[model samples]
Target chain A: GAGVSQTPSNKVTEKGKYVELRCDPISGHTALYWYRQSLGQGPEFLIYFQGTGAADDSGLPNDRFFAVRPEGSVSTLKIQRTERGDSAVYLCASSLMPNSPLHFGNGTRLTVT
Target chain B: GESVGLHLPTLSVQEGDNSIINCAYSNSASDYFIWYKQESGKGPQFIIDIRSNMDKRQGQRVTVLLNKTVKHLSLQIAATQPGDSAVYFCAEKGLDGATNKLIFGTGTLLAVQP
Candidate 1:
């Protein structure tokens, strides 16, 4: 079975630009999560969706970070006016249900110059 | 503020030696915990998990011990191999309804010398 899939394995952009990262969760997974990880650090929570709606968005750093999961499957994490501080690996994970062990994708490395 | 932290930043051991990684969490409401392993260019991979009700759980070549009294968790790997070299993280999730997002601690890098 295919694991969680993330697009644009690497993305390099200038500061103040807009970028979108996509995630495809495992089949039948109802819970999807996004996290950001810096060098030599653990992943930090971002947002999660239980189905089509976000169950929690509190982990989002600011208003510039937004995510959406339409039709209960594919999800896109959008960032507005990217900054150098946002340069990190963006990870996506999914589970069979809430509280279940998460299966993670390789992640998209976003580099804002 | 609630947080999860590790006691060690790195551990270097010879292959065939056992390895232990420790974590401390501040949120007493947290009922579930997990250990994840990550390599250089990949995301975390689930290693093992334990619930608050249980004190210990064992998986292949690994064991997770939980001590709610001290708010501590530890992951032990038996006869560690070269392939076990990676960064290990401990994640905690509180019992807050359907929102199961995890709070992760700073990782510990395990370097195995074969």
Candidate 2:
């Protein structure tokens, strides 16, 4: 694709439910990142991947949040036992290489009711 | 833990006027910086980028100035337009050997009144 793409533009789930957000980055991009944006705030880094491995996952809020880039192209962010505080926009970005300008997707808005 | 912050939370400028948004970063070791514009219901768009080696960089209607000495960065928009109304954010990239990670700052909402 020409730009980064995210699935389920909007998702509403009950508290404690499991939810997954998918992201498809631009072709051949070696770096992918996941971020969470709360209302009235900037996007906060969640995790970063270089190729198929997660080079940085320190930003994940807790053990309930996890992400994977299995094929180095498509990525998934899984949230277990989602809480009401998890209601926010999940953003995905891809870069040609590390430190390069990131191209962001429209993001998936997750509402944990 | 490194963090970036913005000095102003909101800025309003008249159409065709020049606008400047400021940011402060605590990490001095960061090597790369970028400016992004995000409108409501949309993702952030890359504006311009600058390296620590350069003090300033200019793009079409945008300019980024970095001051490592004071740990400050600013984005200047020339001839601001109504279409340019959006939230602007500054991000810093810290290099870990061959890898780099971006750390973003609190954003400033820019409203260009026509």
Candidate 3:
């Protein structure tokens, strides 16, 4: 794709339900990242993937949050037992390298009721 | 516990005037800085970037100045336009034990007046 793409622009899930957000990165890019932006706040890093392997998951708030990049191009973020606090905009970005400029997707706005 | 912060939460500028947005980072290990512009309900777009090795970088009408001595970063937009009105965010990348991580600061809302 020309830019990073995220699916399901908006999602409203019930509390304690599972939700999954998807991200399709630019072609030929090897680095992908997930960040969450809360109201009135900057984006917070969640996880970063280098190819198919997760290089860093330390930023994940808890064990309930998980992400995967099966073939190193498309990634999915899964949240189990979602809470109301999970409501936020989840942004996906991809870069040619670790230090390269990041291209971001419009993001998936998740509103957990 | 990286605290990247903006000096001002909002900036209003006249169209065709030069606008400056300031940011500060507490982590001295940060070696890279980037400026991003985000419109309402949209993703952040890359504006410009500067490496710590250099003090200044310019791209089109955008200029980024980095002051390692004071750990400050500034973005100057020349001939600001109405389309330039957006939320500006500054991000820092550190090279200590933390790598491949960019910490973003609270953005500044830039409003351009005619």
Best by DockQ: 1
Q: Tens-digit lDDT track for model 3 on A2-113?
A: 8999999999999999999999999999999999998668899999999999998889999999999999999999999999989999999999988898899999999999
Candidate achieving the largest lDDT: 1
Of candidate 2 chain A, the 10-residue stretch with the lowest lDDT total is A36-45
| Clashes found in each candidate (C-alpha, N, C closer than 3 A) | 0, 0, 0
lDDT of 2 by residue, B53-98 (tens): 8999999998899999999999999999999999998998776654
lDDT of 1 by residue, B2-112 (tens): 223334488999999999999998789899999999998999999999999999999999999999999999999999999999999999997669567799998889999
| lDDT ranking, high to low | 1, 3, 2
DockQ comparison, 1 vs 3, better candidate = 1
B64-94 in candidate 3: lDDT tens per residue?
A: 9999999999999999999999999999986
Which prediction has more favorable lDDT, 1 or 2? 1
TM-scores of all models?
0.95, 0.94, 0.95
> Per-residue error at A16 for model 3, in Å?
0.8
lDDT of 1 by residue, A12-83 (tens): 999999999999999999999999998877899999999999989999999999999989999999999999
Worst 10 residues of 2 chain B by lDDT: B1-10
| Alpha-carbon DockQ of candidate 3 | 0.55
Task: Please give the ranking of all candidate structures by DockQ, highest first, separated by commas.
Answer: 1, 3, 2
lDDT minimum window of 10 residues, candidate 1 chain B: B1-10
Off by over 4 Å in 1: B1-8
